[model samples]
Target chain A: QKEVEQDPGPLSVPEGAIVSLNCTYSNSAFQYFMWYRQYSRKGPELLMYTYSSGNKEDGRFTAQVDKSSKYISLFIRDSQPSDSATYLCAMSAGDSGGGADGLTFGKGTHLIIQP
Target chain B: DAGITQSPRYKITETGRQVTLMCHQTWSHSYMFWYRQDLGHGLRLIYYSAAADITDKGEVPDGYVVSRSKTENFPLTLESATRSQTSVYFCASSGAGQGLISPLHFGNGTRLTVT
Candidate 1:
């Protein structure tokens, strides 16, 4: 099984609606969860970050991590057309020193917010 | 100033050809990474470097290589390109901190098409 799993969603929603995107992982060792936004022909940009099992809120976005179930989620309030983009969920295990091992990512979910 | 810049924003090459994608960052970050995004496959790490001259393989490393000769640059080379290697390549950098906890800054991706 892939380390991380996310639905490839082209979810369409109306503007001002609430949007939720989620991911699940098979590795319990993953401790850091992150959400990234990518527009067409652009690079993925960091959107939300969380450590372990907890919830973090930034602006209109909220990231929640549940370590027990290895599930992570990102919620966007008052979604806008500008929020139409692919949402990627990424995670990493705790780093041991400066090694280049840790970051693992899931297949992103495409989202669209229409007027 | 450009945080991170990728050269040859778009590239097309034939099979068995050698192509190198260049990534440079102005932040002097201690960590740099190479990831490829394929349709319906999200983003997968190909390689990463914690510091100059230190590198490691990631999830998918076959047919590709990376070198970090300087803190500000990380380049990915396709030794012999294959059709499967056609994907959007992204380079990211992070400050001196633990992975799984640090937020990465990404550059505009390089769209590579191997015919």
Candidate 2:
């Protein structure tokens, strides 16, 4: 199995709805968990990140990681059409070098926020 | 804003041709990376450099070459283009941190098509 796994979802939701995206990994060494948002024809940008396990929040976005279960999630509160984009889960297993061996990414989940 | 730039935002080449994608960053980050995004594959690491003259292979490195002769530039070259090599490529940079968990700054990306 691939190191990381995620559902390729074209999840459609109405504006103001709450959206939850998830990913699971088989590797236990992944220490840094990140969420990236990618717009069409654009590069993925870091939206939120967490270290080891626990929760980190930024405005309407919240990221949670459970290293024990090898699961990570991103939740969007009061979503909007402006939030429509592909969400990718990325993690790294490296030393102090930062992103050593690069990041292992899961197939992104496509999200559409309807107006 | 990252100040990371990629050249030839769009490229088209035939099989057996050689093509180069350029990446440059102004932050002088200690780490640089190359990743390719394909359908159902999210973003896959092609190659990365921790510093000038230090490079390593990621998940998919075959048929590709990278050189980090300078601290701010990381170029990816396709030795012999194949239809399978057609994908959107992104260049990213980051600072040194434990577990390499620092946020990655990515370029707009280069779209290459191999006919």
Candidate 3:
């Protein structure tokens, strides 16, 4: 199985709808979880970041991580057409000395917010 | 101008030709990474560097070479480009303060096509 699994979804939603994107990871050592948003033909940009388990909120976006279940999620509240993009989930198992392997990324979920 | 930037936003080259993608960051981050994004593969790491002169291979590094002669520049070179190597390349950098778990800032991306 892949280290990280995410549905490559072209999920479409109406404006102001709530959107939930999820990912499952097989690696238990991943302590740092992040969500990135990528527009067409552009690189991924960091959206939300969380350490270990728990939830982190930033404006209309909220990120949650569950270490026990090896699951992570990003929720978008009141979505807009401008929010349409690809969302990628990334994580890493960091060492104490700082330097460690690069993050493993899941297949991004493509989202479309309809106006 | 303050963030990471990648050169030759679009490239078209013949197979077997050598191609180099340039990455420059203004932050002088301690960690630099090279990743390629494909339709089915999403994003896969090719190479990474923790500091100048230190480089390591990542998951998909077979056809790629990398050098980090300076902290702000990490270039990815494909000695003999293959059709399979045609994909969008992204350069990212993260600071050392948060170690390997630091959130990455990505460049706009370089789309390369190997004919």
Candidate 4:
């Protein structure tokens, strides 16, 4: 089984709808969790970040991590067309020596906010 | 100001050929990484460097190689390309290693196709 698993979602929602994207991991050592957004033909951009298990909120986005369950989630409020992109969950473990090892990424969920 | 840039945004090569993708960052980050994005696979790390001359293999680093001769440049090379290696390649850099909450900055991906 893959270390990190995420549904390859092409989920479509109306504007202003609340969207939830989630990921599950098999590794228990993952300590840092992050969410990235990738637009077509562009690189993945960091959207949210969390440490260990807990919730972190920024602007209209919220990231929740449940270490015991090995699950992570990203909540988007008031979705917009600009939010239409691929949402990726990434994690890292161990001491990064001021920078951790490479991040383990999920398959990413493709989301579209319809007008 | 260009933060991070990738050369030859699109590349097409034949199998068994040697190809190198260039990644440059201006942030002077301590960590740099190489990842490939394929269908059903969000992004898999191929290699990463903690600093110049300190490189390590990532999840999928069999047919590929990386060198960090400088702090700002992390190049990924496909020694002998195969049809299965056709994917979108991305390079990312972070200011600090794992434990610290550092967000990664990414370059516009390089789309490589091996036939």
Candidate 5:
């Protein structure tokens, strides 16, 4: 099985709706969790990140990580058309010598916010 | 600008040809990485470098070569390109001494099509 699993969803929702995207991982060593937003033809940008098992909130976005279940989630509040993009969950487990090993990414979820 | 940038935003090459994708980062980050994104496969690490002159392979490194001669540049070369090597490539960097959880900054990405 893949290390990380995420539904490649084209989930469509109306504006101002709440959207929840999730990912499940098989690795137990992952300590750093991140969410990235990728627009069409553009590289992904970091949206939110959390360490270990906890919740981190940033404005309309909230990132939650449950290490025991190997699950991570990103919730979007007051979604807008501008929020239509692919969301990818990435995780890493490395020492303090920097994260040169890079990260393991999920298949990504394609979210569409209708106007 | 003070961010990572990738060259040859779009490239088209024939099978068995050699092509090089360039990545430059102005942040002088201690860690640099190369990843390829494709449909169904999500994003997979190709290679990564920790500081200059230190490089290592990631999940998919076959048929590819990388060198980090300078701190700001990490180039990926296809020894002999195959149709399977065509994908969107991204370059990313993260700072060292950030305590194992530094966020990654990614370039705009390079799209290569092998025919």
Candidate 6:
């Protein structure tokens, strides 16, 4: 089984709808969970970061991590067309000392916010 | 802020040719990372450096070489590029990359096509 698993979705939602993206991991060692947004032909940008198991809120985005189930989720409130992008989930096994290995990423979920 | 920048936003090269992607960060972060993003594979770490002259390989490090002659620059070179080497490359840096709470900043990415 892959270390991280995320649905590669082209999920379409109407404007102002709430969107939720999730990822599952097989490794329980991951201590930091992150969500990134990538526009077409662009690099991934850090959106939300959560440590261990908890909920973090930033602007209209909220990230939740449940270490017990090895599941993490990102929820978007009042989504807009500008929010259309690929969302990638990543986690590390306690940073692995200066970013050497430890990070495993999901395939990313493609989201489309219709106007 | 021009935090991190990558050279040659796009490139097209022939297979077997040597290609180098340059990464520069204005933050002077102690740790820098190189990652490749494919259509379905998400992001895979290729190499990383904790400081100048200190570099290490990551998951998909084969056929790739990295050098960190200076803290602000980490370049990745493909000695003999293969068709499979074609992907979008990203450079990232963090203040406390060895820990669990540092926020990572990413470059705009470089798209390389090996023909």
* Top of the candidates by DockQ: 5
lDDT (tens digit, per residue) of candidate 2 on A1-115: 8899999989999999999999999989888888999999888898987789999999999999999999999999999999999999988876542454578899999999999
Show where candidate 6 strays beyond 4 Å: A95-102, B97-100
Rank order by lDDT, top first? 5, 2, 3, 4, 6, 1
User: Lowest summed-lDDT stretch of 10 residues in model 5 chain B?
Assistant: B95-104
Residue B76 of model 5: what lDDT? 98
> Any runs in candidate 3 off by more than 4 Å, and if so which?
A96-100, B97-101
DockQ of each: 0.49, 0.60, 0.52, 0.60, 0.63, 0.47
Compute the lDDT of residue B16 as modeled in candidate 6.
Answer: 98
Chain B TM-score by candidate, in order shown = 0.95, 0.94, 0.95, 0.95, 0.96, 0.95
Assess every candidate by TM-score: 0.94, 0.95, 0.95, 0.94, 0.97, 0.94
Model 6 C-alpha lDDT per residue in residues A4-111, reported as the tens digit of each score: 999999999999999999999998878888898999977788798788898999999999999999999999999999999999998987654224443678999999
Give the clash count for each candidate.
0, 2, 0, 7, 0, 0
| Top model number, lDDT | 5
Candidate with more favorable, higher DockQ: 1 or 3: 3
Q: Which wins on TM-score, candidate 2 or candidate 4?
A: 2
In candidate 4, position B3 carries an lDDT of: 91
Q: Model 3 misses residue A109 by how many Å?
A: 0.4
Provide the fnat value for model 3, as a fraction from 0 to 1: 0.47
Superposed on the true interface residues, model 1 gives a C-alpha RMSD in angstroms of 3.7
> Where does candidate 4 stray beyond 4 Å?
A96-98, B97-100
Taken over the whole model, the C-alpha lDDT of each candidate is 0.87, 0.90, 0.90, 0.89, 0.92, 0.88
Give the TM-score of chain A in candidate 4. 0.95
> lDDT tens digits, residues B12-56, model 5?
999999999999999989899999999999999999998899999
lDDT of residue B80 for candidate 2: 98
